[model samples]
Target chain A: MDTNTPLAQTDPVISDEEFSRFCEFFYRKTGILFDTQKKYFAERRITDRMHKLGCATFRNYFAAVRFEASGEEMQHLVNQMTVNETYFFREDYQLKALVDGILPDLAARRNNGKPIRIWSVPCSSGEEPYSLAIYILENWADADRHDIEILASDIDSAILAAAAAGVYGERSLQRLSPDLIRRYFTKQRDRSYRISNDIRDSIDFSRGNVVDPQFMRQFRAVDVIFCRNMLIYFDDQSRRETIEAMYDCMSPGGYICLGHSESMSRISSLFRPRKYADSIVYQKPFE
Target chain B: MALVRRAAAQIAEDQPSGDLVDGQERWVADLASADASIRRRAAHDLSQMPDAVPMLCAHLANERSLSVRSIILTGLIVNKSPAVVTGLLPFLGSEDANLRNGAIEALQHMPDEVAPHVVSMLADEDSDVRIFAVNVLAALPHPMVPEWLLQVVLHDPHVNVCAAAQDALVEAGEPDVIPALEALADRFPGVAFIQFAVDAAIRRIRGG
Candidate 1:
């Protein structure tokens, strides 16, 4: 019943019936690889449903959730199964580096005064791209009149919904400021807050698959592209291929910001760390 | 959290523009005797600028709108300062949902300093806070996280909160907590849905 424990191979921790339910439920939703080892806990989680269904075993519970689960059920499963521990400004250091340090430099180069178009690849639950909107707003306060655009995308539709709605519970705001909270959020209730229109209108939300060429085709030249935290999940070859594709999509002299512990150091020679005294940033070399 | 923000926004938009940017500096210099509203106002105003962390941190312990408090935390997150976390750790025990959420969000942003505080919240009085704590703890890779996981289940007022806690406990494998799990089961017995989890938790704890 306790899924956290490895279903004992010898003793059979979870009945095959429950394991099948979990595998089907999770895999159908997230496409993750769940082996037998996850059964003890996964079965434990689903078994309670069986009890309610009055089916005493994991097998009965499996069938019910499988049958009852709708599109939303699958989305709920995907949301819970995947680790989406996002906050208001998750990649804080990188964002500040982009706004205070990086954007100013990039601003100097754009002689045509065309608005910078930025994309947040795999922008889960809108927080990532919304953060980008807030970032650019802070940097180029004059950006309102310019062509600056930010597009945030993610494959998971549930998170995109949360991102687009911009209604965050009090829980989501710990790292945010009272002032920013006061200025940017409208109270929904005693417990919930909606992000202000200034931040909300700054972003354009869409559903996209980074791995798909058709999905990638819709994206185009940008001054900066934030594809942080998504690259690590892919195989090396895919990462390399995606990196090359992203390079093509970026404007000449454009920059990309990766996850905190990640780098393009060995990944590609097309981009180099634009060394700065305050923080290290990367820029696409002159093509 | 939401109420504070609406109140502050009115103040920010309506307040006559003055040289109050330095007024925030003056307020923080004393950091004492300022009323809650003044402190709340000052905290909101200063957060507009880049690197408004110190002012945000000043309000870390005080009671503000969870929304207002969240704004400060966002500033801290934007700045990536671990120092703000040391003062924030105690709020994990506060009875406010926003406080707990702020603690969680803060810890998520500043793990190096905030991890230990999250660990302590696992033993909090409120089951909702504990449920969130277990979720936070389970997210981490540290050994203490799994250890805290063993004691994560709590019997509380809300059924959904109980279910959420049970879900987290089931994932963490808090087998040794079977009695508590069973007690929660018995207390809320006939719910039918949760009994198996309680039984399984007991069975697993007994090595059954």
Candidate 2:
């Protein structure tokens, strides 16, 4: 089999039916759904994989994906399909909700004197956890009245190290206003800005995987969690396990903000849907 | 008060009490603990045990807390086997909606293990069981999902059962299933919702 076959000349064309079949299979495997709009994108990636494998037809490629015990090909497809760009305040409506709605509710209901804990799993490159800190400090009037502990984690140790280092390029800071950026970050010699030492020091950044039960066990009584865009890469069982683990670690009435495209109702019945401001979040039932 | 740093020692203080050395028996015993958190932890630990499926499934029935029930179901899903499916199949008939839905959700994740049972489940005398079987197929990743759904739409006498199949076929059906879907609409002409659902399924399968 010649692996260098030109994709256009020799690659088997994917029919609409095959595209639908592949989308369903892919969605089930990774909880990431592709619609008709993504047909071109999906077909291009799949056919590229087929060309590299020298599979003459979609059927042969799909058969390998479905029946292969090692699932290496499937992982490659997942990597091909997912987009992982991150920046500060990319989905800031949820941040607005966090300051305006979620925090006030949490603060009012809290009788315990313990510090309120907010966790950000898979906190890639520190933008999200740092954004949470800046949002609360700048917007929430009660920020000075309550002790807040921000915990950030990621499965990649290198990314976790980067998150702890709290440095960012201009692209990652595009969404921040100049005033807020000036307040929270110090301009570095490299023309990048490093988040202030106080904001960086306040967060406890650690390496953790959501699907690992032992790793998930250390988090307790968490008040809020920003676990966005991470679960879409996980298969069904892992997604369920991750949600259930988060449930156990969270305090009752605690809220979780998933990526806008992700829905808790699709994953588990453990959390009730709570709409705050313009964003929808899931809340652990107070039972 | 302001943003505060929690020491690593403080985080360690939050770890659950039981250790791995507690043995399977201790974890099994803790499955019945009055504390829901302890029961949840026991379920998490028991997921590692090879033979803990039956215990977890049994505990799921008596487990009152939704959190514990979720953990028990996750344990069942993680340890998915024919036995796990057998333990969960009964829940599809459960009067408790939560348990039934939870069972359906868990079964969806174990497509290979649940495949052998799909035929019996879809052919069950209970119309609700048949509907639940279709519900399972709605998300089950198996390639045979479309064929199983077509079987339900073509032969099932219950209108709701056929409707359930049509709902699933909206996503799982191929263009070949369109004729069967049309025939289904013909089979239940008097039912407006059935006609509507069948038409929608046909349009969707056709990518209209």
Candidate 3:
């Protein structure tokens, strides 16, 4: 908490006593290997949390945080470690690709016959799926709406409630055209807007993990799965596991999505990056 | 904590503000260098800027390094720029709640602009973001903030958000917050945080 704590004191040249607690604390908690090899700039992050919580020192906060059984302190710790900066429909290109290339292809593949279910795995706060639902409802016909389903899932149960409600302010909806708002949204109040059932019904709000075996059911019949931006958190093994799982559940000629920077070529030969003019989507190999 | 301690030590050792700036400039130059040690040192040095609050706010978006960004958040609430908050407007719909919360936190420091978004966050269903939005309303001035805070304080799923809502109500009260808070607490006794929050808000509202 002392404002006097200099940055150099936080540097690698520090004595063993100064930041050893943080070195042990973070490395143990996240398995993020924060030793001499990496020289992770931990003093500021660790100490800042200590100061904010009024724990006096990193050592004190570390003891309380490391020993805690339930995840509150641990969750707070992870929150401190991560710098979350996201907005709704952040890469319009990704969803735009869905509206143009992915949806049409899926609809045609169905021969306008079967439901085109899409899953936004780890759909925190509903933005991803709601955006997906909105894209489908607005660009395509509600008459064709029976053809698509978006199952939005997240590991966090608490965030799912917010995603289910689908309310937003003028800011969250700033990019949204007013006409689109009028067509696809139900105004909850002067300050709020909720996606109309026309869009919300396409999303089956639920809780599922990208890790456990239980998650396979949610992806059972997905034609196009847009799992963007969540892969950055997974370790190699889990990433491979999830990629395999997503591949397994993909219906014939179904597609898969990942964060813009993620690639499927490295994961498996079964998924060929579906090259389009403006975007790169992935498709399952035709059996 | 080390930053505070080390800054205190450097204050004892350093020459003048201009020299510090020169040193800071050098560090900034090396921020993206291929040398790992230099990058590490630059990150360490950057975390110590006395004017870090304003400087870090300016540099926040440009910095690609997560370590540096985390360090920026680590220091005393810098990046308190109205611009930083405004820039985040596009990201409001981001599926990442952490990003949403960061934007919310950045917005909290700018009181005039803070009210509108804080109001928006109160209505946000994500309990964490809603709770954080309530916290921003706590520090700044918002008349409507209380009603919304009390509403969530009584009902939110995340205990922390409820606590923040209760605190915001205490800081900035509305006429109906008291009765509504009391009723909510009475209805949801299971939420001990809400009950405690109601007690605190009611006590404060009665002008305690």
lDDT of 3 at B56: 49
Q: Write one digit per residue (lDDT tens) for candidate 2, span A1-287.
A: 33234446656887777687777777666667888787677777888888778898787787677645345688778777777899998899999999989999999998788788999987988999999998899889999999999999888998888998888999999999999889888999999999999999999988878887678868888999999988877766788889988997799899999987678876888888888889999999887
Most DockQ-accurate candidate: 2
User: Arrange candidates by DockQ, highest first: which order?
Assistant: 2, 1, 3
List of clashing residue pairs for candidate 2: none
The clash numbers for all candidates, in the given order, read 23, 0, 24
Q: For model 2, how does the per-residue alpha-carbon lDDT over B98-194 read when each residue is reduced to its tens digit?
A: 9999999889878899899999998899999888888988877677777888899899999999998887776544568889888999999999998
- Model 1 C-alpha RMSD to native: 21.1
For every model in order, the TM-score on chain A comes to 0.68, 0.86, 0.68
Better of 1 and 2 by lDDT: 2
Off by over 4 Å in 2: A1-81, B14-21, B182-208
State residue A186's C-alpha deviation in candidate 3, in Å. 3.8
Sort order, TM-score high to low = 2, 3, 1
Q: Which stretches of candidate 3 lie over 4 Å from their true place?
A: A1-86, A141-146, A188-190, B1-208
